[model samples]
Each structure stands twice: as C-alpha cells, then as structure tokens.
Target: MSDSSQLPYRPCAGVMLVNQAGKVFVGQRIDSTLDAWQMPQGGIDDGEDAETAALREIGEETGIDPSLVRIVARARHELFYDLPSDLIGKVWKGRYRGQRQHWFLARFTGTDDDVKIDTDHPEFRAWKWAEPSELPAMIVPFKRKLYEDVIAEFAPWLESIA
Candidate 1:
C-alpha cells in the first residue's frame, strides 16, 4: 500500500459484510499480495456514485449481489500507507493519487454458497468470518484506523445483531 498521507485522499467506498453469527466477512488477499485481510472496497469511478461503487466492489470481490444485502451505515475515513514499491507504476490508472474511502456496513441476506474468487481480477484468495476486533492484526497497518472507525461505529449494532 502507498503511504496514504503522501498520496492524498481519493474518493472510495468499502463494505463490511456481517453475518447473523456476529462474525464479519474478511478476505485474505491473494498470495504475497497486499498481505492483509480486508472488507470489500474500491475506488469510485468517474461518473459513478459512491453507493454504486460500494455495491460493485462487494459484488466483484465476493460475488454477492448488493440487493441481497442491507445497508446499515456509511462511514468515512482517510488512510495513508506507503505504496508497495513494486506497484507504484500500476496505480489505479488515473489521477487517484491515493484512496479516500467511504466505508459501508451491510448484512448478508443470501446464502454464502454464491461467493467465489475471480481468477482474472483475483483480489482475494481465501476468506473467513471473524470477530471485528481481530481485524486490526490482519489488516495493513495504514488501513487499520479505518477499521477502527468502522468497528467503533458498528459496535452497538454488532451487539444488537448478536
């Protein structure tokens, strides 16, 4: 990840998918990839809206239809991490510079069987549900604060869901 502070904030959206068991969905990045587990997120495309991007990212990453999920909250956070030196060249192909993510919370209403890893884009290799507090250790350090904001905002809902 690029140093988020150095890069500047770009508009983005993330989705936290929580199940009835109180476990939130997390995806293990592809091997030697970003080297972190994360909720679904992506940059907002020009002419595309934030909610649209959030729904799109969730579907692309987890194969879950946005319609099957309910939006519980929308949280905003700015994160800065050094761009992995190797990927400095392949940035999002535009003027993004860095990611300014708007995170969303959702609960899965559909069966889990539909989730699959896409070999072409290959964002995540493995996935599992875990307690929200367990996330910081598994996420990229630069992005941990965003998860913190998310968890803090959702802690009460998490209890309610439980």
Candidate 2:
C-alpha cells in the first residue's frame, strides 16, 4: 500500500449539535447500508471559513438553520483519519484518501421540531439524538477513532451542560 501522504486528505468541517439535554444529533446516511450514524459534516467549500463551513454543513445535512445553534467550542487543531484501503480510490471521486476535519460543538437552541432531515440534497435518511458517550460505538468502524477524538475534545463542553 502507498503511504497516505500520496493522497490528500479532504478538508471538511463537522458539527456536534447538542440539545438542551446535552445529547448529540446523529444521522443514518443515505449512501451506506451498514446502519452507521454520524454527526453533521461535509466538505469545506473553497474560500469558506471552517466555522462557517461547519454551520453550513449542519444546515445542509440536518435542514437546521445556522441561527438555531449556539457555538460551544471548537477543536484547537484539525484531526486526521485515513480511509480504509479499499475506499482510498472509490470515494470523493478519488480526490482524497480521507478527511482532515475541524469539528465544532454547538448547542441546539431550537426544539426537535426545528430539525428537518429532508434537505434539498439530503445526506441522511434518518436521525436521532444520542448520548455523546455512545458516539464511538454508533459510528462506522473506520470512523471510530475520529469519533473518540471528538468526544475527548468536546467532553468538557458536554459536561458543563450536563
């Protein structure tokens, strides 16, 4: 296998949208059959700031407007994860080997009614609120490490409200 450096990592932003109860939102992807769930995330568009991209991703994936969330915290640095070897050349038009993501923690001020998963370009088919501690097990195996890191980085903020 070629070293990961041979392919660039996708620049992406992830949002950990938490409600008043402090549970994070997770979605079942429309493109996968494994029943894996994930927080809102997407590519960072050219010329867009990470925070703005994160908010945009939330809106695009969850149909929740940016106005509904209150920023809680942001990771001090981007986190990297390599795609599985079989996925290295199949996903993202083979442009990226994996994702290097900047994750944001945001509190959902709006009620559950505000979340509409059926967006114009829906990435998820179903969704729910789950304990942040359950994230690692809920995500796809390939993304577990990234989810674990997300929990670690966002733990204090989650605890503050719990």
Candidate 3:
C-alpha cells in the first residue's frame, strides 16, 4: 500500500513514433521476460508537460534524437489502463495501479540508422519498426486494450500523413 497507488493512476505520457514507411517503433523491454514489447512511454515528471515527457522518454528509451521526431497528433484525451491485480502491488514501487497517459503521435524524420537503442538509461533490449496494426498484439496482454486505443487514435500517423 504505497502512498502513490492509494491516490490514483500515475500521470504518464506515451509515443507512437512512426517512420515515413508508416511503421511504428516497438521495443522489447529489458526488464521483461514475457516477450512484452511496447512503444516509448514513461511517467510525466513533476512540473513537466506531457509532450515534453513523451519526447524525453523517447530519447531515454530508444536513443532517438527528439529533433528527429515531428509532432503529428496528440491524443484527444488521456487514456488509462490498470495493472493486473497481481502486479498492482509489485510494480512501480507499488506506487501506481497503472498509468493514465497522454499520448503523442510523431513522425520519425530521420533514417533507420538514426535509431540507436543504446540510450543512457536504456529501457529496451531490442527494437524494430512494425506495422501499426500489429501493436496491440505486440504489447503485454494487460496493455493490449491501451495499445488498441492508441492505434485507433493515431490512425493518421500510421498512414504516414505527417
């Protein structure tokens, strides 16, 4: 019963980074053994804006220069998903039930060679570009619904419109 979890969902930001080919970036978390992959996401630091958090998380998790991503879309509203009961008290220092995230869709303006996963505080062990349709199935089961919502919300980015 962490004080934070008792409050509500953790404030977070997420990114759907799409390349010119319309493929979204996916990463295999270094901390997971379940083959759970995810888009870049993380807590929105105190006093930081959601968009800023999204960009920072992208750089920290994937080593992509924030300058190389052009904003395409922002989620119309925040989206939430709860961690499984078994995980609620075991993850994030038991400080969050899950995340309530503000998602951003950005176009990767750089080439594939510009992606360097060896970030300062690396969160991913591996990464790749995959069709947006595959996102929901690629993430952890608990977050599938969240991914689906994200994919739907950023359908335009998936079409390479940005």
Give me the overall lDDT of model 1. 0.75
How many pairs of residues collide in each model? 12, 0, 0
lDDT of every model, 2 decimals: 0.75, 0.91, 0.88
Runs off by more than 4 Å, candidate 1: 1-7, 31-35, 76-90, 93-97
What's the lDDT for residue 48 in model 2?
A: 99
Candidates 2 and 3 compared: the better one by TM-score is 2
* Count of clashes in candidate 3: 0
lDDT of 3 by residue, 36-151 (tens): 78999999999999999999999998888999988889999999999988787788877778899999999899988888898877789999988888988899898999999998
lDDT, model 1, position 125? 88
Stretches of candidate 3 off by over 4 Å are: 1-7, 160-162
lDDT of 1 by residue, 1-162 (tens): 645345555678888788888788899877556668988888788999888898998888888877888887776444433444554546666334556677777888777786776744878989888898998888987667667877887787777663
Evaluate residue 110 in candidate 3 and report its C-alpha lDDT on the 0 to 100 scale: 93
Ranking by lDDT: 2, 3, 1
Q: Which segments of candidate 2 are over 4 A away from where they belong? A: 1-4
Give the candidate number with the greatest TM-score.
Answer: 2
